[model samples]
Target: MVLISLGPLAGDVHLLNRACKGAGTHEDLLTEILIGRSNEEMFLLKEQYRRTHNKDLVQVVRGELSMKTERMFVMALTGTRDESTFVNHQQVQQDVETLYRAGPGKIGTDEIAICGILLQRSDAHLAAIAQAFPQRHRVSLTHMIESEFSGHMKDALLHVSRGAEQDGQGVYRDTQLLEAAMAGMGTKDERLCYRISRYHWNRPRFGAIKNQYQQLYRRSLRQRVEGETSGKYEKALVGIIEQN
Candidate 1:
């Protein structure tokens, strides 16, 4: 099947206004946008929304959505993938630190968030997260779950974080990535949307990105990032991982 490059179209306002005006619910729109569409299709859809609606599409959907469904759709719409592989690694490390710092009762939100982020990464990165969890926190991630989380949430989190080494390891080459992003003629226009989009959908990496903040600018990558960029593009350049 051809990959969709539409980039979060269904979530935009034209479609969303239709939903908001009682044409269809947000869930219906989300299904159309995220399911069985190529990235190009998603990108085009977002553009269509912007043209038709003066307001940002994501805001429209978020204004209406709630709970888990909201989480899923908003994540789809944010769609920021312009990041370095090493930056991703650094993000993972930062997440681990956040997990370690949080108290037991405070672990749930951050824990699930990290797991969600990690899901977007390759097996290689997943393994690293799992391995590092215990070493950094002085307790196994699994044990943390057993003690803190329960039921399906616990089960799901464990499954996603099981092995990171294979996850983020072999998928993309760092040198080639840097070359493509920086050394090429299109460097100024470069966007690592693939990596961010991958992680946005990827549960594990999404979780990690929430708390991890190690961008090239020496700021939290999360703080530096702004979804659906318009001006200056500082969000794209500041958060990329530096090439060693």
Candidate 2:
């Protein structure tokens, strides 16, 4: 499974356990569970994870992942993301400069520094930073992240970046994730199911994201699913897409 929204702490715990229990972690699933969570949400998740799994979520993460990816999850597990809608332009500029130095301006990528800024900023503040970064560096922050990072770390950072909204629309990231599940030759059934299920919890917003998905790809998300999946799976995925 790829993701879930807040609440139903048990679902989050189940997904986290599934991601971390085996030999190799499920990076995409791990990214979705940990990214975009509020401090309170993360607190509930950590508590639930311990009750359900009898292991500290952070400790399990430390044991499962290594290097920059591990550091990124650890910072996210701190449950300290600034959640205010307030944007600080000065700080955004500073972060932009820091990212520039950490990425394109440096000889080698400073992965942790980049992780710190992405992990700490509020969504509103991060959206501001994303805008300022492109203006200062002549490349979009998403593009820069793609250039400088790879693997799970890159995916997590991209999740953080796109989670920030532009012009008050918050569906872009979700829309992108939905398409990613069905993109390429074969469909990612579990990811597709989890993503649609996650969004289906909020009908109105899910409706908006689905409409945006159609606008972006010039084909209906439902139509895309119809083409990629068949049998009960096709009907089920299409039903959810159509429900939106």
- For model 1, the stretches where C-alpha displacement exceeds 4 angstroms are 1-45, 48-56, 67-76, 87-91, 100-127, 134-244
* lDDT tens readout by residue for model 2, 1-244: 2243344577778878888876888988899888878899899999988887788999999999998788889999999988888787888899999999999999999999999888887878888887888789899888999999998899898888777645333588889888888888788888888778767767898888878988899988888888888998788777766762
Instruction: List CA RMSD, all candidates.
Output: 15.8, 2.7
Residue-wise lDDT of candidate 1 within 129-150, one digit each (tens)?
Answer: 6677777777776566567655
Q: Among these predicted structures, which one has the highest lDDT?
A: 2
Candidate 1 local distance difference test against the native: 0.47
Q: For candidate 2, give the lDDT of residue 191.
A: 85
TM-score attained by model 2? 0.89
lDDT of 1 at 6: 37
Stretches of model 2 off by over 4 angstroms after superposition: 1-7, 165-170, 242-244
TM-score for each candidate, following the candidate numbering? 0.34, 0.89
Scored against the true structure, residue 198 in model 2 reaches a CA lDDT of 69
